[model samples]
Each structure stands twice: as structure tokens, then as C-alpha cells.
Target: MEFTVKNVEETMAIAYKLGKFANSGDIICLNGDLGTGKTHFVKGLAKGLEIKEHITSPTFNIVNEYDGRIKLYHFDVYRVNDPDEIEAIGFDEYIFGEGVTVIEWSNYIKELIPKEHISVEIIKIPNKNLNYRKIILNYFGEKYNYIKEIFI
Candidate 1:
């Protein structure tokens, strides 16, 4: 599904809607350029998950764990030199574990991603309002198909 948002709040609101239906073992891959509000999207997701703590990109640490109705494993692989760098941190455990996982800059480690996952791509609309963003969401397997219905 595709959506256009006029500003940051609308962008986060869309993500928040998805997060409300998030289930354990769900993998959400986020692809966007710098300043595209990927982290803001995550912040709204965390709120929807009932997480009370602040959310921030784990650029240096690689991943940040949050406690919520369902645990959230937020990963930032933007600075990763190799996909193995993620494996070294026990990537499988988190993605396969009983929690929701969101990976920022996921395109960097696409080969390592599971075939069944949800993908969100945020694009800046050139010549449009500076805060405008085009968000596209795609699901990979039957398990995630229902998510598409939410945006509809």
C-alpha cells in the first residue's frame, strides 16, 4: 500500500496504525534516505506498542531493545560494514524471537532478511513541501498480507 503524508505527524500516525496491530515475531524492514523520518516512524510505533521510554536510532550500538505490550527490537544497520556484522550480534535470535523487530536502512542487509517480512519505504517528494513524504508499504508473505488491509 502507498500513502502520502503532509508532515511528520501524519507520517508517524500511519506507522502508529501499523504498530497497533503488530504481533510477536513480526519483522518490519524500513528503507529510506537520511532525514526521511525513519526514526520518527519508529517512535510512533513504539508508542502504539505502549512503550513508555523514548525512542532513538541505534546507529552506534546497532540495536536498541524496548519493553512494551510486545517487546520491540529496533535495529539500525546504516553504519554496518558487512551483513556479518549483524550476524555477529546474534541477529537471528532477535528476528526469530518472541518480539517485533524493526530494521532501519534494511536494504543494507537485504540478503540477511527473511523472505516473509513487512517492508516500508519512505521517499521525499522533490519540489513538494519539504516535510512531505511518500510512504510505501509492502508485505512479503501470507502472514503479513493482513497488514495491507489496515491502510485500506
Candidate 2:
């Protein structure tokens, strides 16, 4: 579904809705340009999971773990130059682990992602005072088909 976010609050609301349906073993691929509020959406996800800690972009750290109602593995692959770099960090353990995983700049390691992952794409519109964004949702497996009912 397409979302016209007027500000960060709206974006977080969308993330909160999505978070309610997030489950273990779920992989979310976030695609967008820099300063597109990717991290803001992630903060909403953490809140939905009942996480109390602060959530930030995992740029230099690469990954950040949060303990919430369920485990959350946040990844930022913008600086990663090779797919092998993902493996070096043992991303599989988290991608396939017992928690929800959200990957920023996931397009960088597209080949490493599972086929059944959920894809969320955000686009910024130029010349708009409001932080306009187009959010696209694509489900790759039967497990996520129900998500369409909620957002689409």
C-alpha cells in the first residue's frame, strides 16, 4: 500500500501497525535513501514490540540488538561493500533466528535475503515541505498474506 506521510509521527504509526503483525523468523527489508526516516520507522517497531531502550541507526555498529516483547535484530548494511561481509557477521543467525529482523539498506545484500521476506520501500518526494514518503509492501510467502488485509 502507498502511504503519504505528512511527518515522522505518521511514519511511526505505520511502523506500529506493521509491528503488531511481526513474528519470529520474519525478515523485513527497508529500502530508501538517506534521511528518509528509516530509523524512525524502526523506533516505532521497537515500541510496538514493547522495547524500552533507545533505537538508533546501526551504521557503524552494523547491527543492534533489542530485547522487547520479542527479540529484534536491526541491521544497517549501507557501508557493507560485499555480501561476504554480511556472512562475516553471521547475519544468518539473526535473519533466521527466533525474532523479528529489520534491515536498512537491505538492497545492498538483496541476494542474501530469504525469498519469503517482507519488503518495505520508502521514497521521498522533492519540493514538498512535508516529509512525504511512498511506502510499498510486498509479501513473498503465505505467512505474510494476511498483512495485506491490515495495511492494503
> Which candidate tops TM-score?
1
lDDT of 2 by residue, 25-56 (tens): 88999999998889999998888888899999
Q: Pick out the ten consecutive residues of candidate 2 with the lowest summed lDDT.
A: 126-135
lDDT of 1: 0.93
Best by lDDT: 1
Residue 16 error for model 2, in Å? 0.6
Candidate 2 wrong stretches, greater than 4 Å = none
**TM-score for candidate 1:** 0.97
Q: How many clashes does each candidate structure show, in the order listed?
A: 0, 0
For candidate 1, write residues 1-152 as lDDT tens digits: 88998889998898888889999999999999999999999998998898999999999999999999999999999999999999999999999999999999999999999999999999999865367889999998888877967877
